[model samples]
Target: MPARPPARPVPPAPPPSPRDRLLAEAMRLFGERGVDAVTTREICAAAGVNPGAIHYHFGDKDGLYREVLRLPVAELDRQLAGFDDPGLSLHESIRRFIQPFLFDDGSCNAQLFFREMQAPSPVFMETVAREVGPLFDRFARLLARHAGMEQPNAAIHQLAMGLQAMAHDYSMTRPMLDAFHPELLADDPLLEQTCHRLADWGCALVEFERQRHASR
Candidate 1:
């Protein structure tokens, strides 16, 4: 038998940099446990980097957590940014806002965001101003139009917040919802039906409020 040719040397895989490693591990840990429960030492250990790397890269542990929390909100903002067509109806607007959270496909870690909402920090407010507020403002305007209200009124503002709260409940209560309402998790058709139902539910409330104001 002929001798085999010399074996080729395989290229070594490039290791993730300290910053990237810290970010990945931070998100994983934060998702598993809320931000308050995680420590910088654990994050560095999980990422296989020096403890000081957190400060060097992100200024401190809080900064790192802020960055972690910021990730999904930024994604959500990008997802909703394109929903600016003037022709969108109230139900369509509500559906679009709710779509990103429900059928996320792991693009944005909805659990991480929900955790932040459960235990809010300064980062939560910062994220709101930076990424979330504008999206809500857009929804508020659309909601006002559908509700037959003037811009920036107390009614419209309250209604917009209520609409968002409804969407959040749908996203955060999935485990319980799945147990109680199997059809919602079974297929896209049922899921969409649920979404339409939710949107119509919101529109009905808005219409009622609008009519109430008109009657006064």
Candidate 2:
């Protein structure tokens, strides 16, 4: 029998670097005009890639939105490694979570990260829960514990939702803060103040829960 010809050398596929690529573009556009104003063309323009790239890579604008949001979510997860603080003080755990979003020694990563969360899309919100739920849920239990609540209570999750609501109040209005309250919103000042405020707000709730838990 004749020997088979040598197999053609297969080239390794190009790197998807699209995650970072799309993220950078999404951040630029979303940060500039907010999410609704910026179209996929703008994202592609900022990204210096074809419009098809976004569709080819992320399924659609919403998919790209998920990927954009995921960057920070994944970053948060990395910083939170080994944070098995199911029993950690709720206020402190909340503080740790808030710190990453509010502060970054690096350049625009922090600011860009925050905009996505601040100006959420419905699509982003759908994925956001699944992506960030467990970590925040653990913090919910910690909050309940700090308030001396027993397991299986709805209050714990509600408290978690409250924390998000509060943070979102400040974070979602960040552009307004920067424009109308620039000094307070300066990254340095905001980062510093946000960390303390988040803890203070969280701790304040702990006291409220304590009373409620005791009353029951």
Candidate 3:
């Protein structure tokens, strides 16, 4: 009787917006093919939805790509924002930050990240450099801190670029894993292991850089 006095309202199911569908399709296609190779029609075809969806959602191909990349970039932003300056040790700090770039978000929706990594669109690259680039620079500082480099300007920048190169392999070589590094193929359990290992390796690289600087 008490519950009947105030019935709970049913929550509405979230409707998929036209833009959302198009962006999702764009991510899938872009992940499969190089950015230049993915066409609008192809995106529409793969989406199994109307061609106009892209126009309605994003106006143009570049717009669609930006929308797609926003997902991963947003996540990157959130993780970086939560960086605790005091609590994280050097190795822990590097591993925590680097995992998102290389591993799937436990949902396997890593297409947009892979696309950008493969062929870095000028528009997207500029956007990242302005926004996420600072985050990477900050993370590079974390690496530098562990490496004991007081001034990490050039050295840490190189490490940041190296981490990016390593992450791209997950999407760049989806098939070649059949013959080489099959265990390391992203589809298997090995990928998670690989990401952690790479984090350690990245930290090690920074450590070496720190040593060089210290020696000087």
Candidate No. with top lDDT: 1
User: Considering summed lDDT, which 10 consecutive residues are worst modelled in model 1?
Assistant: 101-110
TM-score ranking, high to low: 1, 3, 2
Pairs of colliding residues, candidate 1? none
- Ten residues in a row with the worst lDDT in model 3? 103-112
Among these predicted structures, which one has the highest TM-score?
1
Error of 3 at 209 (Å): 2.4
lDDT of 3 by residue, 47-96 (tens): 77787777777788888877676677786778756553758766566666
Q: After superposition, how far is residue 56 of candidate 1 from its true place, in Å?
A: 1.8
Stronger candidate by lDDT (1 vs 2): 1
Q: Tell me how far the alpha carbon of residue 40 in candidate 2 is from the true structure, in angstroms, after superposition.
A: 3.1
lDDT of 1 by residue, 1-216 (tens): 999999999999998999989999998888778778889999999999998999999999878977887777777778786564678777787888876755534323555666767777787778678777878787777777776767746777787777767766766676688799877667753367767777898789778877877798
Q: Which of 2 and 3 is the better model by TM-score? A: 3
lDDT of each: 0.77, 0.71, 0.70
Rank order (by lDDT, best first): 1, 2, 3
